[model samples]
Target: MPSRYVIVGGGIVGLATAHRILQDLPDADVTVLEKETAVGTHQTGHNSGVIHAGVYYKPGSLKALLCKAGSRSMADFCAEHGIPVKVCGKLIVATEEAELGRLRELYERSVANGLEVKLLDGPAAREFEPHVAALQAMHVASTGITDFAQVCRVLAELLVKGGAQVRLGTRVTGIRADRVLTDRGEIPYDTLVNCAGLHADRVARLAGADPQVRIVPFRGEYYELKPQRRDLVNGLIYPVPDPQFPFLGVHFTAMIDGNVHAGPNAVLAFKREGYRWRNVSIRDLAESAGYRGMWKLGRKHWRYGLDEMRRSLSPKRFAASLARLVPEVTLADLTPSGAGVRAQAIRPDGSLVDDFLIVRHGRQVHVLNAPSPAATSSLEIAKHIVAQLSA
Candidate 1:
C-alpha cells in the first residue's frame, strides 16, 4: 500500500510540504488538515513579505542555511509561477556610534554566510537611500519582497493538481497511533507532520510528543506611510538590531504592492490570534501568565516590554521610533495598517528559540518553532523536512 501522509495546518510551510511530497513521491496519499477555511490566514499572510538574505542568523544554523537556499529557491519558484517578486535589496543602518559596532558585526556575519554585502559610510549610504539617517550601513543585495499569500495559493493549486487532498475547515481533535481523529471523523495515516503555527505545542502533545518548547505569541503591529510620504523609502531600510532581542527594530519595508510599511513593534498578545489589545482570551492569557518561561522572560525584559506596549498604544511613539532611521517620517505621516502574531518558542529557562526547530516522534514530525523568515524560507523548510522523512 502507498504511504498515507497527513499534514496539520495550511500555512505556507504545510502547503509547501504537501507540494514537496507530491513532487518526490507521486503515489503517496497526502491530506492537509486546516482548521481555518482558507490557507495562509495567519503568519504567512500577515508577514512583511521580505525575502530574507540570511543576514541576521548565526552562520551554520538551519536559519542561515535554509534562508540562503530558500531565498534563491523562492525567487526561482516565483519566476516559474509568474508571481511578481522584486529583489530590491535592503540597508541595515546605524544612526548612532554605539550601533556601528553591531552593524559591523552583522556585515561580517553576512560575509561569512557567503552573501553579497557591502559596507557603506553615511554619505555613501545616502546614495542608496537618500532619506536614511545613517552613520554607517550594510547593503544586503539579496533581500527582496513578494506576496506570500499568492505563493501559498499557487502551491495549493499545484498540490490539488498533483491529486493531493487539502481539507480546509477540518480540525484535528486527536492523534492516535496510526490515525487522526478530527471534528469530522477518524482518518488513518502512515505518517503525520504538524506545522500548526500558533498551537504547535498543543498539537505535538496530541501526537504523543514532548516538544519541550512552548509557543509564546508575540503580536507585531505595523503602520503604513501615507501615499505622499512613500517616496521617503527606496527599498528596505532597517536598523542594526539589538543582538539581545529576537525582533529587528522598526524599519521601512517597500512592499510589493507599491506602499511602504513601518514600525511593527513586538508586544505580548493576550490571545494567540489577538490582532488588537481589545481581542483577549482569558484562557490563553492564563496559560501564558502561568508559564515559568513567560515570567522569566518578562522579569528579564520588563523595561523593553513596557516600551513596546507604549508603541502599541501611542502612534506618536511608534513614528518617533521609526524616525531614528528615516528622519523625514513623522506621526502625521503614519496610519495603522495590520498586525501579525509570531509563534515564538521559549524554553523553560526563558531563552527564546533562535532557529528553525523540528522534532520527530515515531512517524510524526513537528515544526515547533518557525518565525520571521519562515514565510521566506517555506519551500526550503519543506525540502529539509521531507529529506528527514526519507532518511
Candidate 2:
C-alpha cells in the first residue's frame, strides 16, 4: 500500500510539498490541512513579493543554496503556468560613506553565492534609477518580483488536478506519532509534514519534537507611493542592511502591479497575525513577552526596537527613512498600505535564526523557521523535504 502523508499547513511551502509528493509518488495519499478559509492568507499573501536572488545569505548555507536553485525553478514554474513574473532586478544602495563597507561586504557575499552582481558608483546607480541617491550600489541582476499569492493558487490547483486532497478551514488541534487530531476529525497517516508558518513551534511540540526555537512575529509595515510618483522607483531600491539585524531595512519595491511599495519598518506585533497595533491577542502577546528569547532580544536591541515602533506610529518618520534611498520620496508621496508579520525564529540565547530550520522525528518533519526567501525557495525546499523523507 502507498504511504499516507498529512501536511499541517496550507501556505506556499505546504502546497509545494504536497505538489512534489504527488508528482514523485503517484500513489501516495496526500492531504493538506489548513486552518484558514483559504490558502496564503498569512505570510504568503502579505509579503513584499520580491523573488529574491541568492543575496545576503551566508556562503554555502541552505538559504544560499536553495535560493539560487529555487529562483531558477520559480521562473520556470511561473512561465509554465502562465503566471506573470518580472526579472526587473534590484539595487542595494549606500548613501553615506559609513555604509560603503557593508555594501562592499554584501557585494562580496553575492559573488560568493555565485550570483551575477555589479558594483555601481553614484552616477551609475542614478543611470539605472534616476531618482535614487547613492554613493555606491550593488546591482543584482537576478532579483525579480511576482505575485506569490498567485503562485500558491496555481500550486493548489495543480495539487487538486493531480488527485491530492486540500482541506481548507481544517485546523489541526493535536498530533500523535501516527495520527493528526483536528477540529473536524482525526487523520491517520504514515508521515506528517509541518509547514505551519506562524505556529510552527507549537505544532512541533504537538508532534513531540523539541525544536528549541520560538516563533516571534515581527510586523513589517508598508506604504504605497502615490501613482504619480511611482516612476521615481524604476525597480527595487534597498539600503545596505544592518548586519546586526536580520531585516533588510526600509526600501522601495516596484511591485508587479505597477504600484511601488516603501517602508516596511519592523516592529514587534502584539499577536501572531497582528497586522495593526490595535489588533492584539492576549495569549499570543503573553507568549512572546514571556519567552526568554524575546526578552534577551529586546534587552540587546531596545534602542532599535523603540525606533521601529516610532516609525510604525509616525508616517513622517517612516517616509524619512525611505528618503535615504530615494531623495524624491517625500512623506506626502506615501500612503499607508498593507503589512506582513514575519514568523522569525528566536533562540533562547536571544539571537534571531538566520537560516531555514527544518527538523524530522521518525514519521514527522517540522519547519521551524522559514522567513523571507522561503516563498521564493518553496519548490527547492519541498524537494529537500521530500528527499529527507525518502532517506
Candidate 3:
C-alpha cells in the first residue's frame, strides 16, 4: 500500500510540500489540512511580496542556499503559470554616515553568497532612483516582487489536479501515534508535516515534542504612497539594518500591481494573528507575556520597542523614518495599507532561531520558525522537508 501523507497548514510551504509529495510518491495518499477557509490566508498572503535575492543572510547558511536557488525558481514558476512578476531589483541605501561600514559589509556578504551586486555612492544611486537620498548604496539586481498568495493558489490547484486532497476549514485538535484528530474528523497518515506558521510551536507540543522555542508574533505595520506620489520609488529600497535593534527598518517596495508599499515597522503583536493594536487576544497575550524568552527579548530591546510603538501610532513619525531613504517623501503622501504578523521563534536565551528550524518527532515534522525569506524560499523549503521523511 502507498504511504498516507498528511500536512498541517495550507500556507505556501505546506502546499508546496504536498505538491512535492505527489511528484516523488505519485501513488501516496496526500491530504492538506488548513483551518482557514482558503489557502494562503495568513502569512503567505499577507506580505509585501518581495522575491528576495539571497542578500543579508549569512554565507553558506540554509537561508542563503535556498534563497539563492529559490529566487530563480520562484520567478520561473510565476512565468510558467502566467502569474505576474517583476525583476526590478533593489537598493540597500545608507542615509547616515555611520551606516557606510555596514553597507560595505553587506556588499561583501552578497558577493560571498555568489550574487552579482554593485556598490554605488549617493550621486550614483540617484542615477537609478532620482529621489533616493543616500550616502552610499549597494545595488542588488536580482531582487523582484510578486503576489505570493497567487503562487499559493496555483500550488493548491496543482495539488488537486495531481490527485492530492486539499481540505479547508479543518483544524487539528489532537495528534496521536497514527492519526490526526481534527475539527472535521480524523486523518490517518504515515507521515505528518507541520507548516503551521503562527501556531507551529503549539502544534509540535500537541504531538509530544519539545521544540525548545517559542513563537512570538511581531506585527509589521505598513503604509502606501498615494498614486500620484508613487514616482518616489522605481523599485525596492531598504536601509542598512540597525545592529543595535532587530528587524530591517522601514523600506519602500514597488509591488507587482504598481502600488508602492512602505513602512513595515516591526512591533510585538499582543495576539498571534493580530494585525492592528485593537485586535488583541487574551490567550495569545498571556502565552507570550508569560514566556521567559519574551521577557528577555523585551528587556534587551525595550527602548527600540517604544520607538516602534510611537511610529506605529503616528503616520508623521513613520513618514519621517521613510524620509531617510527618500527625501521627497512626506506625511501627506502616505496612506494606510495592510499589516502582516510574522511568527518569529525565540529560544530560552532570547536569541532568535535565525535559520529554518525543522525537527522530526516520530512520524511528524515541525517547522519551528521560518521568517522573512520563507515566501521566497517556499518551494525549496518544501523539498528540504520532504527529504526528511526518507531519513
Clashing pairs in 2: none
Best of the two (2, 3) by lDDT: 2
Once fitted onto the true fold, the runs of candidate 3 whose alpha carbons sit more than 4 angstroms away are: 244-246
How many angstroms is residue 110 displaced in model 2 relative to the true structure, after the best TM-score fit?
0.7
Instruction: Write down the lDDT that model 3 would get.
Output: 0.92
RMSD list, candidates in order: 0.7, 0.7, 0.9
Candidate 2 has an lDDT of: 0.93
Separately for all candidates shown, the number of backbone clashes (residues 3 or more apart, or on different chains) is 0, 0, 0
lDDT of each candidate versus the true structure: 0.94, 0.93, 0.92
Compose the digit string of candidate 2's lDDT tens values, residues 1-391: 8899999999999999999999899999999999999999899999988899989899999999999998889988998998989898999999999999999999999999999999999999998899899999999999989999999999999989888889999998999888999999999999999999999999999899998999999999999999999989899999999988879999999998898999688999999999999989999999999999999999999999999999898888898899989987899999989999999999999999999998988988899999989999999999999999999
lDDT per residue for candidate 1 within 22-87, as digits (tens), equals 999999999999999999999999988999999999999999999999999999999999899999
Q: Candidate 3, which ten residues in sequence have the lowest lDDT sum?
A: 240-249
Q: Candidate 2 regions off by >4 Å?
A: none
